[model samples]
Target: MSEKMKKIIKIAIIASLVSSAYSVRAQEDELSNDSHVTTSFVKRQVAQNMSIGRAVKSIVSNYPQEASAVVSTALDMYPDKYQEIIHAAISAQPMLTEDIVKIALEKNIASCANIVKTAINAEPSYVDFVVTAAANSTPEELNEIVRVAVITEPDSADFIVQSLAQQHPNKIVDILSSAIEAVPLVGEYVVETLLAIFPNDAESVVSTAVRESASERANVKRIIETAQNFGLDEESIYKYAKEGGATDEEITAALSEATEQR
Candidate 1:
């Protein structure tokens, strides 16, 4: 097997071996001392497709502390098991990831890139994880995140714009607006990203707003109008739409209007 597959398997094994002991206090060298910080703890478990999700869920429930190691080892040992772990990440409550994911986000994109590449290879469907990790990353790190996120999940224009607005507001607005204009179908995501900019609309409009407002303003308006449009809603729109009285038709019409604005 390839080296990447080997790492994932190791992590899956660790997930299988985890116990519910109140505490595991051992030396850094020996997991018996610290369950959250060792390679051996990961080697003892067995995570099949059926159990992999649960195992991953358990580890992520303890995220950052669990770090990229669990998924890393799992991809190494059970390459086929990566997606199961990512799905668990998606559905598992209290979303979290290995500390290495954060360290990489905080310190260097290369570090995070290595881990995310493993995730992408093992679980191609979970490319969004890379996008998400980039989104949550610090400012200097965002551009690199955006570069990778777009390459990995090109369909996620909103993620790209959001990253630009959230991280490099000064240079990003016009650039992103141009991208949105070029790809009008998903222009709403750009506008949405604009809204997400701090100081709110002021930041968003500074980009392609006034210049493109006449032609693209409607599209831009739809996404920035509501606080939720800017991702500031009390609850996620997806969940709200599920529970709210608005019908699918209503939402679709709204989206259509937004898309047709420019």
Candidate 2:
């Protein structure tokens, strides 16, 4: 072939190859965009049609960290189905409960307390996480949470109280007082835990329990016994108890009983 014809043929071949490569690239980009849009639409439909339980299972099955965000959003959108969704999600993926609770608290979700309470109630074993999360809440909110926890799960009261007390020693008296008030039966356990952790604050703890729990005679007796067992002097116990509103008759009877025991 002539040189010019040969060169023309080679140029045409190169041009054709370049055009084919551009067409393939354009097609790939279009396909990529279509795939993304289709995936997103499917996800939305799945979310809308599936039950919250299935939605949660699907999300947490792969994206565990997104559990809280998903739950929080679900709660905002479905106020009426609050408990149902929460229970369903937690029931489906128990491990995600902690993440759900932590995110709820971090975001200051209004129903954080109820969520924690429900989570703990459903699985008492999560009490530690629930209590820890509640510790970050306002004092009043924390108090209410503690009250509900102690009242509902009295057995978990000791652990809950101890965790909060250790975290906020200054609030020990108030926390214990609330716990004792809710379930006076927990008073003895509270006293024992308090004295073990805050021996120096024993007087304050006893006085608060006595003053606040005077109506609860059994609780008062438990406090007095706990104080005595901790080696607090009889006079100091009586004086604090008196200052805490123990009746003269109640103090005398308690001290007399203590002496007999000694």
Model 2: per-residue Cα lDDT over 1-262, one tens digit each: 9999999999999999999999767634533452321333324534775765565555544444455655666655555656655665666567766666665565554565676777786567778667766676545577777787787689988888888888788888779878887888888787778888888887788888787777788678767877887788888888878777887777777767766887
Candidate 1 residues lying further than 4 Å off, grouped into runs, are 1-32, 35-44, 47-51, 58-69, 79-81, 97-132, 135-163, 174-183, 192-262
The CA lDDT at 74 in model 1 is: 53
Which residue runs of candidate 2 sit more than 4 Å off their true CA positions? 1-50, 61-65, 92-96, 106-112, 248-262
The local distance difference test score of model 1 is 0.48
Q: After superposition, how far is residue 199 of candidate 1 from its true place, in Å?
A: 7.6
Q: How many angstroms is residue 17 displaced in model 2 relative to the true structure, after the best TM-score fit?
A: 37
**Residue 133's C-alpha lDDT in candidate 1?**
60
Each prediction's RMSD over C-alphas, in Å, is 15.1, 11.1
lDDT tens readout by residue for model 1, 1-262 = 9999999999887776674232332322343234343444554434332475676666555554454556555555555555565445544532343333443444332344454554444444445544456456654445455555445555766655664555455656554545444454455555555555654454344334423433544453343334244544433433333332334554455445544653
Best by lDDT: 2
Clashing pairs in 2: none
